[model samples]
Target: MTTQTLDGVTVNTQANVYFDGKCVSHGIALADGTKKSVGVILPSTLTFNTGAPEIMECVAGSCEYKLDGTDNWVKSTPGEKFSIPGNSKFDIRVTESYHYICHFA
Candidate 1:
């Protein structure tokens, strides 16, 4: 199921803007020290590189992502998720606003 809320989280007020404001996110930390990010992607196509493995969970809307070394674009919607490896890159395409929570794995 999609995560609707997070309790007892310490949020960073600063926004992380990317792709010239096509994407924006806020970092959050749970009581257990688990870090995550909540964000939205506007209509655009962008490539992102990862320093750590991540699980991108879609809480609303949708996006199609193509992982490095692959040609297939997988669609992720509410309650769905995709994984990306560390040191790898992925291409994401969105036609509308896509809301997500990024989980580090």
Candidate 2:
């Protein structure tokens, strides 16, 4: 694992980075043991499945997402966030490089 101190909090990066060509993310464990991921999604439309509830905070660029059971796509930009339920799927479309921090709980 790799470790880095951000804003005085040390985060331990998981050894296996998650990627599927369109997006890449590194899992991190916060000092308080919270699991999270910081990642960039390349310009593409992708579907993702989650095992736990997630709160995604956008840090750069923007993205449009349609949550499970929703037909409308919500737009989110920097400083914005969206939540997804556990054991569900969501679709996201990014026009540019989108950076985000995902908090898993």
Candidate 3:
């Protein structure tokens, strides 16, 4: 199911801007100390490198992502998710907007 709300999270007010502000996100910490990020990507193709494993969950809109070393571009819509390994990178293309939550693992 889609995560419509994050009930108990301490959010960082300052946004993490990337790709010349084409992508932006706010980091949030849950009660149990689980860190996550909620963000939106504008219309652009961006490459992101991960230091830790991450699961990208789409909450609204959609995106097409190509994982490192992969030839296919997979579509992620609302309620869908994709995983990226630690120390890896992924390419994402957004035509409209992609609202997502990044779950750290």
Candidate 4:
């Protein structure tokens, strides 16, 4: 479904799942308290994990992310999945409107 936001941004949400399914843009699934989304032009900032491990799969486009703000920035693209460790902070910047599936486990 295409959910219309007050800001005029349109997002499609499908198959809300508790453990496994497709993700949406900035929508928090009630089944899991984690945030899952296909980000667009994600600004450079720190992503701090506060719970269990989260899974991110690069479906399209690319991203340059740095782990712990110390590790070098790495380029990730399609068919790649990165595990974000819990309690660690990572910085990310999207070169385009990349599609990603983030599973908060």
TM-score-better candidate, 2 vs 4: 2
lDDT of 2 by residue, 6-85 (tens): 45345555433445567877776667777787888899998989899998888888899999999999998888889999
| Candidate 3 lDDT over residue span 1-86, tens digit each | 78899988999999999999999999999999999999999999999999999999999999999999999999999999999999
Show model 3 residue runs off by greater than 4 Å: none
Q: Weakest 10 consecutive residues, lDDT, candidate 4?
A: 15-24
Q: In model 3, how large is the Cα lDDT of residue 48?
A: 97
Q: Lowest summed-lDDT stretch of 10 residues in model 2?
A: 1-10
Off by over 4 Å in 1: none
7 in model 1: Cα distance from truth in Å? 0.9
lDDT per residue as tens, model 4, 7-98:
33333455333212222255444433445555444433334444667777777777877777576888878778777788776667765655
What C-alpha lDDT, on a 0 to 100 scale, does residue 100 get in candidate 4? 67
Clashes of each: 0, 0, 0, 0
TM-scores, in order shown?
A: 0.98, 0.84, 0.98, 0.56
Q: lDDT, candidate 1, residue 56?
A: 96
> Would you give me the overall lDDT of model 3?
0.97
